[model samples]
Target: MGGDLSQTEVLVIGAGLSGAIACQRLARAGIGVTCLEQGEWNPRESYPGDKPDFELQALGPWNANPNIRRGKADYPILDDTSDIKPLLFNGVGGSTVMFSAHWMRFLPSDFFTYTLDGVGTDWPIDYHELEPYYLQTEADIGVSGLAGDPAYPDRPEYPMPPLPIQPWGEKVAEAHDRLGWHWWPGSNAINSRLHQGRRPCVQRSTCRAGCNEGAKGQADQSIWPSAIAAGAKLVTGARVARILTNPQGRAEGALFVDEFGVTRKACADIVVLAAHAIGTARLLLKSVDAAWPDGLANSSGVVGKNLMMHPMNRMVGFFDEPMSSWQGHWGQSIYSMEFAETRAEHDFARGAKWNLSPTGGPLNAALYPLDDPQPFGVDLHDRVDKWLGRSALWGMVAEDLPDSHNFLTLDSAHSDVDGDGLPRLHYETSENSKRMLSFMAKRARESFGAAGAYEVAEQTLAAEIGWHPLGTCRMGNDPRNSVVDKWNRCHDIPNLLIVDGSSFVTSSCVNPAATISAIAARAVDRLIHCRSEY
Candidate 1:
């Protein structure tokens, strides 16, 4: 539980995608980097093979008792008035372990939100500025797909070819084309051609749970191994409580509780916080001191403000033919944006894109069609059986604008077993976001109808809780409106860098992982060049 802190050059707090990539880059640069993860490192063999076991690992065990336990200590969940539930990963690989492998880059327009559309703040850097880094990240991650697809930017074709399209995927693509929607093989981190000594995807339907076949690109399988080989150290079961700053107001180290429930300190010349959006913000707020009365980097008072979650909605359709939607990777096929650009011309509140998703297992599928159940028994079983393979589901991921009201704060009442306060999230869909959701629902219905679905049922608007959370510690040129600067260095604390979803100014319609990796890589490049002076 103890280590020599003086020898560490860079300390990364969280071993997620961003943290893993950053640590790798730092190690490649010959920097002595140490990564601290709150959960134990579960190897590929540790993943479950059965569906019930997979469900328990993926969603059930956490849901049954919403507390993170590292050995004997339990981290409690704080209840907030917000309708949305904050979900985050606490392990070494972080959410990348359970991610659907959708590695999509944000559109060019996603960066210049202010100049192009005037709805959100413009990024200090744009797509063109990040183009090279995006290409590097894609190559590093071994992305699988063809380039020259109109939906994505022109770049080198994916390092690996696209996975073999499933029958359900082909059907969904046909349906999308018939409805004049753009459809393409999704850019995935899963291997299609078995590059880098990893095997190709075996078409396992259980990607949401950890992948045992090494097809899905979790950091543990991809970046962590390389980082460790390059002399970087990864310390798991180390929960970072707060960043410790020197009197000179520079980040020197962190205060953390190790696996044995013992308080420890780790020092580094530079500290990078990559604990996703909520975790990063919560940690910053918890590091309050006399120099930083409000929070470590809250001079602008926007550390945990302007939180955004891309509220996701789904439309499930039942067909006469068997679609077999659950046979492939979680997000292997995507119906592109024939409608994503609608906001460019129309008066739409916001835009959305429909992507093909797994239809779920029997128990999960039954809940989707249950608006009101008829007489139970054989009739219900018959109805479920008939629609099992014949169903195709499409998810609409719409961008939710950043609002100051949607935020994360520490709850005084709920403290973890380690005596650390829990983060209580307060967020709801804005009126504008609700309108956009309705517009997207209509468009999804039209697409399903064109696909000749026997029954198209749009999901009811439940509480807006999604895995894609962003913009809590947004980066911008204006210090008053944002938490970090263009370089992602905290405005108030020059030595501390926040590189993750928390730095996103706006949540794009697509997955934010690619962008997050690109930004972290860019930040590392900056850190390397100015290390001697800083």
Candidate 2:
């Protein structure tokens, strides 16, 4: 409460994936926009993968888990109550800084889950409504992929051609064909040919630790530069402590700590929260006031409930010959949707999306912290050599149904210097998710066996792989049951907007970045069109 109280037409919290898109769209519309990001922009040269000793650094400082990295920008997360640990980065690009850049969209059946499968709640919006935005965001983010896959509906081609499938990819594809299962070249955010100013991928296979080749579609590399070039202003190293609301229960702005550790207030006509699911829900729950005793826009008591962290199961195939697996795009060579949609015979209702990815360098095979250690017992050197250039993984991203018990809340046990409670994740893998994982594991081994794998390893529900956290502050029509409406506006406060994965109603099995961008774009477009309504 010391610095000058600032005001902007639009205030955006978080400079991550969806937040960057909201800033871009609002700035493009000539609106005055200011974004406050908890983390500073990381220098491209600072990324570890460029150095000769990259594997050493990737294991230490560049790890995706905030609890492990503990960088200056990262905050502590209480995850002892959770089965699967949540993973995210706290920088301008958010978790995109460390993501494998797997760009995927929800299938048509995904939106109609409650209608068709009678499981989780249905979205107020549908796939068809978001399809145009998906195409637009794909072009904006410079995605690379082949168009006509039988797994999806008719869509336009990607901005660039698909990356090379390599010998390993070809083997997997041929096996899928022989087994009569649906598989297609993976949609990657990396560049095949130079489309934007960014360069093509060098295929270093150290993608999870940031790309030195400037190919992966992290928001910092692909979105923010242009957003800033437009009229948007981005302030780094600003951690929002609380969202402000007026007597009318309308969002005013946010109270945050600046880089210099000074408390400040930023007021805006409209405030947008795009800090992903966990961060967004935490902020809302922490924003309790007199008008809204529980939290801002907590009429439904859904601000921090129904958390869905898209849980994944990892299984790998060890081949006889060298696949040169360390040198290709680790962003998924190909993906199988044979179990993406539910079958009538399935005891479980929804399904999982499986991505085929290359196993990384020798250091990755050792498994210090990245994932569950492969079960090969002794002869460490021999196992590392055997697994390094010979294994490919079929990781299943399973759909997580929303349950109130598996949620996020401020941990009462832990408090920061300001005495504010830290965010804690309380999640349990459901029986349906377990059923999906078990079923997919069997099918995955069969598919790999078809590709002539001599041996296969299974790691059921690894702890360090909650890459897609979603559905905490879900969107729906009824105010009593949901946090936000179809337009991405909170039911309790229309002036307050949430344009992130936190607004998801259902956790689709595929990667959520593409859908997050689409939803952000659509939400901000509506905001621009109806700014006076607020």
Candidate 3:
């Protein structure tokens, strides 16, 4: 256990999105960095998108839900008491491997949620402070879209033109135009054209399962390889058990299980955690010691509190036109921000974002879920034929207010199914989220009707759509109420940093991949410049 693997200037845990960014930055700065990832690199060709049985595979083995996936890398989160199931892919890319690659920035209003909307607490840093990092991350990860949307403040152009908004999307766009609503071509991490040595998307549309063509900007393709080339050392299948701290209460490194089942201790001057909201919180709570009897850096007793999952609703519009609706990138074609910000007219304090995306293949069409379940046996062919190329979905992501009652806890199991202990997630859909979903779903039906959809069906409060896990470990100016500070440094442990969704102060309605990258880059910039202090 006390060998060559145990020494580093900096030790980064979870070699996913933020971990990749941290390594890349530190390596570029010539800092000695070593990263440990629970999952190994999944080769581009290994993705199931190009395979013949893509649809069947997507439902089971390649599913985004870790409980269903149960891959070698994935650890389960007990969700029997959860309103929405936790969905994450554990690999070099993290959840980006399964994400549809909607690259969105948080609106300026999002930073001052508590002040502007009288609800969730405000973020320590504002959008203007994070804007530069956002631009940097977009360029680094290869985002594609036409800019100059009026929904937010004016911005610069995108790297490439917008991805094709298919016929189904065009209809919705036209409807939004007619209704005088705000609809813009979606900005996505998936390539519209080629950029940074990756192929352009051919639009096979199995994005959630994984993009085999390397068109989507998964961290494995877009971030990690470059980090490795820049001299960062990444060790795969290194499952961290707990963080190691010194007598002075500084982060020394970590204790982990190597691929060969050997318990190893890594020594470092600084430690960073980029493990997602659930895993990062779980890891902290599990890393208990005399100094931190509750959890590492949990002096405020809020390490795993204030969970926000961005509860969602889906509305399907069935058009008479056969537009090959299933063929395009499942990534958003267009998104509406007409109701993104709060208004006094609405009883809810915050808002929801509506994204127009393609529904999947035959199996997804046949088993298409609405408020009422469809029976499997009756008129299967008719159902499939009607839904296959005629359906498009408007998914509403509603921002949830952070609640202390919604939290993550550890079961007292010596070993879980993976022999790595499992975490239990307790969540209840908030009244604010339910109200917002109801209001947005009704508006979605109106938009569909305006788009000339023959029939519109709704799936309100979908349990299967918990994609954005955030706000478990919030950042704030006061150490008494938060886990991290404005710079993402732990208030209790000076040398420990958390640069992932776990540090989010408020849940934004849009997808958080872009914001997460920006946060990591911004935090590391501080770390590199202030290295002498640590």
Provide the lowest-lDDT 10-residue window in model 1: 64-73
lDDT for each residue of candidate 2 in 1-534, tens digit (9 for 90 to 100):
357456899999999999999999999999999999999998788898878878888767988888988999888989998988889999999988899999998898889898999999889888899999999999888899999998899998899999988777788899999999989998999999896799998888888888887899999999999999998999898899999988777888999999889989889999999998999998888887677777778889988899888778888888889878878888988998899898999878789999988888887777623234543557557668768889888889899999999888887679955587899999999999999898998999899899988888878887778898898889999999999899999998889999999999888899999999999999999999998987
RMSD of 2: 1.6
Model 2: residues with Cα > 4 Å off, grouped in runs = 368-378
**Each model's lDDT:** 0.76, 0.88, 0.89
For all predicted structures, in order, the TM-scores are 0.94, 0.97, 0.98
For residue 40, model 3's alpha carbon misses the true position, in angstroms, by 1.0
lDDT per residue as tens, model 3, 182-237: 89998999887888889899999988888888888889889887899999999889
Ranking of predictions according to TM-score: 3, 2, 1
How far off is residue 306 in model 2, in Å? 0.8
lDDT of 1 by residue, 1-534 (tens): 465345488999989989998999999999889998887676777676344555445445433223432222225445356655555556777877777778888888887766777777778988877888888887777688877778767788788888766665676678778776788877788888777888788877777666788877877787788889888899888888889999888999898888787888999888899988888988888888799877888889988888887776777777788766656777556656766653655555446666776676565565453434542587768657755767767777776778899887877677755455677778877776677778777877777777777677666453423567799899988878888888888887777888899999988888788899999999988898888745
Candidate 3's displacement at residue 380, Å, is: 2.8
